[model samples]
Target: MSYEECVIVDIDGTLAEFDAEAVRQWVLGEEKQWLPFFEHMAQALPGVAVARLVGILSAQQQKIVICSGRPASYQHYTQTWLEQHSIPFDALYLRPDDEDHLADEVVKKRLLQRIREDGYQPWLVIDDRQAVVDFWRAEGLTCLQCAPGDF
Candidate 1:
């Protein structure tokens, strides 16, 4: 299928819900402490909106892509997390382990561009940050902002 028909989703504040403490630890780069919390997040259920979206997209045969700022080192846990939530995905592109210095928006823009170049037309992007979704929208990508309470 063409890239334009693809739906890209973010994790963290978008699909998976994380407690404040867990988020704080992750943002603080406390990997040792955050790893366990992240594992728990894997088993944590996603919000209804995300679950419904995943189901509808999967049924339509649309490509469901995960484009998160998460480092690639967490790939295994992230995948397991998605599976545990029964989220369907066609592709997942995470940040390289060394790009911790880059902002999420920068990483997202770059990756989204790459996805387009790779021949997947992104039809929609679901993200939690208003700014991120605004940026995507400004770039002519349709984006949905996930409500904060849903995170």
Candidate 2:
């Protein structure tokens, strides 16, 4: 397919349910706390109903690219969850494990740039964060801010 047919979507709060409370607890820990929370999230968080959107895009012969702020270390669990939930995706992008401390918007912006540089002419993005949506809009990209209820 061509780059014009590709769209990007976020994971947490968009396509999957995230345990913010658990994440807060994990962040409060002394050290290596994120590890346990990562494990917990991998198994606990549920997938939202993205099949409808996937089907719609599929019918249009468009591509769905998953772009998440999740660390690369969790890529395995994330992929497994997507598979189990039957969420269709043409590509998956995650944050580098070493840069987990960076802001989500910054990381996502960089990722988006990389995607464009890699030849994906994404015209639309579905994200849960208003900041991300705003960023995309500022760059003249179409974006949808997905509310929790919209999932």
Candidate 3:
């Protein structure tokens, strides 16, 4: 088929779930002391559903983006998780800015603008947050509602 059918997925509450509690536990205290807990928390939010759906798209050479508010520090964690588990996605777009420990709407918006300006035309965006969805819709872009494990 044509690229018109390509799929682009988001991370938080979509392709993957965020363990804010666990993350907070790590950050609010000695992170090194909670390394295993952090890993466990991230690992426990598995993406089986998304992975299976992605498998279908992968066979067709479709592009996928695991966009997330979480910083890219977890990029390697996600990358390894998906790759080791046979999950398929063309690229991963973790937040690039680190002005703070958390990502805000402005950061997401800026990234979205940059992605579009760079000539990326995602056929459809699968995201849970409506803010991003609304932004995309305002630009006349297509999108899909997604949840963790709906892969």
Number of the top TM-score candidate = 1
| lDDT per residue as tens, model 3, 19-117 | 445455554342233345446645655456766777788787776666655556667776776676666776666676453343345556666665555
Error of 2 at 55 (Å): 3.0
| Model 3 clash tally, residue pairs | 2
Model 2 compared with the native: what TM-score? 0.82
What global local distance difference test value does model 1 have?
Answer: 0.78
Clashing pairs in 3: 49-151, 50-151
Q: Which window of ten consecutive residues has the lowest lDDT sum in model 3?
A: 26-35
Model 1 clash pairs? 3-120, 3-121, 4-121
For model 1, residues 20-121, the per-residue Cα lDDT tens digits are 455565554534344665766766668778868877988899989899877889898889888877899988999877777776788898888778887888
Per-model TM against the reference: 0.85, 0.82, 0.68
- Residues forming the 10-long window of minimal summed lDDT in candidate 1: 25-34
Candidate 2: regions farther than 4 A off: 1-4, 27-32, 44-49, 148-151
Total backbone clashes of model 2? Answer: 0
Q: How far is candidate 2 from the true structure (C-alpha RMSD, Å)?
A: 3.5
RMSD of each: 2.9, 3.5, 5.2
